[model samples]
Target: MPLRSALAAVLVAIIWGLNFVVIDVGLEGMPPTLFLALRFAVVIVPAIFFVPRPKSRFRDVVLIGSFMSLGQFGLLYTALAIGMPAGLASLVLQAQVVLTVVFAALALRETPTRSQVIGVAIGALGLIVVGSGRGAETPALAFFVTIAAASSWAIGNVIARRIGRSGMTSTPLAGLSLTVWSALVVPLPMLALAFALHGSDAVGFALTHLTVPQLLSTGYTAWLASLVGYGIWNTLLARHPASAVVPFTMLVPPIGMTTAWLVLGEIPTIVELGGGVMLLLGVAITTGVLGSGRRRRLRS
Candidate 1:
């Protein structure tokens, strides 16, 4: 990947990392489903009118929204509400990296390089270490639900790759347009589901009780994380292979853990710190920053 795209990936990771903490704050005094409804509601209104639709099939747009927006966030928010710590949620969601690689290989025929395979292995080990260190207070149901969320996200990543390779979009800018349009498709279904799952009365109560933290969290997630973050992310995926882009997400767990500690006072244990270092090292290898030079020398 080019340096600019690499930097863009890192930027998205940072935005998404801090996003966990924001979601935790936002869920306070709000039902998870209703909070998601509000976030997507903020994402679509007004902007949808100005942003042109992506140059892809309508079905493709719907698929992106279903998996990426609805499935991913729906499970994720519920997991957090049920007892998943924000920092651990961040780490567990990295399971999407493995899933994306599998899907990309089978669907896109984009084989992973040796370094990437190795990096993923190392990252998986780190995830195990981090998970083992999770406090007993965390619920088993939350952990499994988060795993489902990661799978949903991985499926969404594959769908995105399909869209990018379909020749439906002519340019990277079209990718951003697609992100906005697909996001527009998410809110209605999500709102309906929210009502279906958590009665209208509960939804109404949460909406009426909006606190400052909730409002700010919704705004940040809607504008910055969903709009800006996904916009650049889709653009990068359009311009690069899935293998090149997805590994950058490995950077999120450490950043998420750090932000959680600083903002929420959730201190990390020594095992988590060790796991974080391993995760970073894995990302470095996967991104070609650490091992590429040695590989090139050996090849010569």
Candidate 2:
């Protein structure tokens, strides 16, 4: 990848890492599902009018929206609301990195390089370490729910890659358009879920009484994270192999954990911190940054 592309990916990681803390803090005194509905609603209006629809099949757009935005964020917000720490939630979500590689290979026949395979194995080990350390402090239900969110995200990544690789999204705006258009799939179902969980009256109360912090959080998530971050990300997915792009997400946990600690006071346990280090190492190996130089020397 070019340095600019690499930096862009890292920028997305930082934005996303900060997003967890924002969600955790902002969701206070609010309903998770309802907040999600409002976030997507913000993503849709006005901007959707200017952005043309992605040329990919409508079903592809729907599938991407369903898995990536709806399923992933729906479950993730719920997990955080129930008990998952923002820092650990960020750490655990990196499971999508490994899952994305596996799903890409299975669904897209985008074979993983040997380093990718090894890196995935190491990354999986890191997940196991993190999982083992989730004691009474982290709710078991929340941990598993976040894993489900990761699975949804992985499926979405594959779908986005398929659309990108299909040569359908040829315009500079296709990725952003795909993001905006697909987000249309989120609100109604989330509103329904919110109503189911909290009753219509409660949902109405939360929406009407939104706090400034919550509104700020929604703007950050919708515009910066969903729009700008994913706009760059989907574009990158179109240009590079999924394996090459996805591993950069491993960089997210450090930023996520650090910000969560500083902002939310969610310090990780020793074991969880160790697991995060292992995850970074795995990402290094998976991205070929760790071993490529030695391989080049041997080749010479």
Best by lDDT: 2
lDDT of 1 by residue, 87-155 (tens): 878888887877677667777787778987887788677767766776776787887888799888988
Q: Candidate 1 — worst ten consecutive residues by lDDT sum?
A: 279-288
TM-score of 2: 0.95
User: Worst lDDT window (10 residues) for model 2?
Assistant: 279-288
Clashing residue pairs, candidate 1?
A: none
Q: What is the C-alpha local distance difference test score of candidate 1?
A: 0.82
Give the Cα lDDT of each candidate: 0.82, 0.89
Candidate with maximal TM-score: 2
Candidate 2 per-residue C-alpha lDDT over 211-238 given as tens digits, one digit per residue, 9 for 90 to 100: 9999999999999999998888888888
